[model samples]
Target: MAVVVGFIPTPVGFAALEAAQREAERRGGPLIIVNVVRDGMQGDPRHADQGQLERAQDMVRRASVRIAVRQEHTDDDISDVLLQVVEEEKAELLVLGIRRERDMASHLLGVTVQKLLTSSPSDVLVV
Candidate 1:
């Protein structure tokens, strides 16, 4: 079974990675860490591409995580790509990090975690 972890643009992303790593380790399943590059950067494509991806890779490396890491570009909302990956990869579990916010309006409006939890057919684990 594949464990899919969604990497967002916050510390929560790393937290999610850590939690997923632990769960994957326990379950003895392959883990795939994916960071969705959202559209809208007014700089060199190479720089924009490498900036976030490299950091994410470094985090995995530093964590000594034994998992496959993939970086993907998406023009659509983050939730869209996340759900697509879940289906395409046949992920049995989805893990994400959600920052606690007092403003429920923001999350209810359209947060990635919320959308993933509601839309995913498989089990979702939010750290």
Candidate 2:
């Protein structure tokens, strides 16, 4: 199965991509880059815009790794979208970047990452 690396527009996300690239290189497997964008008012009306998909493809191209980039527009929360992508791809691995915070413990106490970790059915590599 392909390795699906979920990308977000964050420093941690980029770092996770780097980690995924390294792992892909070592394993000699194809990588699929996915960016889950929420579309709507509470999220962003332009989340489904073609420009966003182009940008995601550009980012994947710039990564210089053989990858198939996909932009998923959904009304669901970002974390939920990510898990959905994982299930859809039946991915061999999932890579994510952990954002830097003033207090790591406090940040982990929040919802996003913790929720994903708790709900994920596959191996997750947090960078």
Candidate 3:
């Protein structure tokens, strides 16, 4: 089984990749980097651009783990895409970047995070 990481072009995304690298190393497994966007979506600030994806690939290559990077455009929710990655990749763990929010609405947790925490069979690591 591989280690799966949700990736974007932000610092938090980098942190999640780093953490995933360590986990993959420890497990002696491949790394699956996943970036998902809604079908036909454009210019979403949360998604990574081509250049950023290339940089992320370089980083993964340098990490020396067997790697697969998937930029998937899906109609499904991001959480479902992530969970699908976990199942399809047979991932041992799922890693994601998270930023703390003080807003009361956010205290309930984001929909994606909540769905994964409740539905995922694999362990999750939030970095």
Best by TM-score: 3
Best by lDDT: 3
| Tens digit per residue, CA lDDT, model 2, 1-127 | 5567777655666677778877766666467877777765445532434565465566556544478777877776777878887788676678877667756776566686787778877778877
On the 0 to 100 scale, the lDDT of residue 95 in model 2 is 83
Model 1 accuracy (lDDT, Cα): 0.72
The per-residue C-alpha lDDT of model 1 at residue 116 equals 85
Candidate 2's C-alpha runs over 4 A off are: 41-66
In TM-score terms, candidate 3 sits at 0.90
TM-score of each: 0.75, 0.74, 0.90
1-127: candidate 3 lDDT, tens digit per residue: 5899989888889989989998998898799999988776778866888899889888878766798889988877998989998999889999988764445357337788889878887999877
Cα distance off (Å), candidate 2, residue 82: 1.1
Model 1 residue 62 distance off true place after TM-score fit, in angstroms: 8.5
Backbone clash count, each prediction separately:
0, 0, 0
**Alpha carbon lDDT at 79, candidate 3:** 89
Give the C-alpha lDDT of model 3: 0.85
